[model samples]
Target: MLEWLAGGAEAFIGVFNEGGKVFIAFVTGILPTLIVLLTAVYAIIELVGEQRVHKVARYAAGNVFTRYTILPLLAVFFLTNPMAYTFGVFLEEKHKPAFYDSAVSFVHPITGLFPHANPGELFVWLGVAAGITKLVENGTAPFSLAKLALFYFVVGLVVILLKGIVTEWITKIIARREGVTL
Candidate 1:
């Protein structure tokens, strides 16, 4: 499954690379530009909506921060880093319902949610989960630890590159629209 996904991503990259003018103009240029324009429009709408709901001074910065910074941060981190996903899970656990831990305990008979009840246990559980996923999906009983590490590293690199390109383009559009010299 991983290989299949990797192959597909490679194929898309190949298309972008070899398809030249048309593909680049669409995928690398127009699509991203449209997303940036949409983001700017959404930001404007949010500012107006917030001002209508409450005092402009009270909600303006928060709305801007959420749209321009927070959402972008989440997109970049989640795309590139597996560890970031787990970190978010940990943070979410704190706000979870009373039965959240109990639910985990009920499922996953072997691990019984015990392995993920704490931070230290959580990392161990993640490794076990990754190993099990690799095994079930590929018919390999167990996956090599080194291979898992390498996979994480590669995923991290992908997230970094894709996010960098997306955020940079979006920033350029925003800056231009806002009349920032940079």
Candidate 2:
């Protein structure tokens, strides 16, 4: 029993050692890129100024169409990973954005689908959609870029719209019940 336990422990340690190397390599590869991206984002924010950022947020959140559709789409497509943190800071400094605006901006498929702001994610998604289309069509047809784009657009739109609407409604309700103005 002692030998068996020792063997198992040795195996586990060996596995962990190899896994740790891989983890370290991944972090080393990703860290520089992340630092550069974050630095650029921060520098741009500073150059743009707090007031301009607040104005953009207010404009984006001015209406349901802009709030639910345009804002989230732009956040995901353009801002990528930094949108949430940037907006959080802006909200803290300006206190102008609504809960829904921040919520929708943060809760998008950008990071999951488009890590590092790479457009290659769209191609990957298109490939997946093509595979599904092939399965649906029994390998009779290829999926078009237009179809893939439409599918991506519709899915993104629905997610942002639902999240924004629900967040706004719930926030308003909670604030009203607590006798607080949002």
Q: What is the C-alpha lDDT of each candidate?
A: 0.41, 0.57
| Model 1 vs truth, CA RMSD | 19.7
Give the distance in Å from residue 147's predicted Cα in candidate 2 to where it truly belongs: 13
Residues 1-182 of candidate 1: C-alpha lDDT, one tens digit per residue: 99999999999998877758655655684456545654664475477673352332223223323322332233222222222222122222222221122222222221212221123233444556656777867887555645554564444334533443455456567767998654
**Backbone clashes, each candidate:** 1, 0
lDDT value, residue 66 of candidate 2: 71
> How well is each residue in 61-180 modelled by candidate 2, as lDDT tens digits?
667667666665545544654444344332322223443354444433443333455433334543465476676678554565455556665776677676666766776777779988
lDDT of predicted model 1:
0.41
Q: Supply the global lDDT for candidate 2.
A: 0.57
Model 2 misplacement above 4 A: 69-108, 113-157, 170-182
* Highest-lDDT candidate: 2
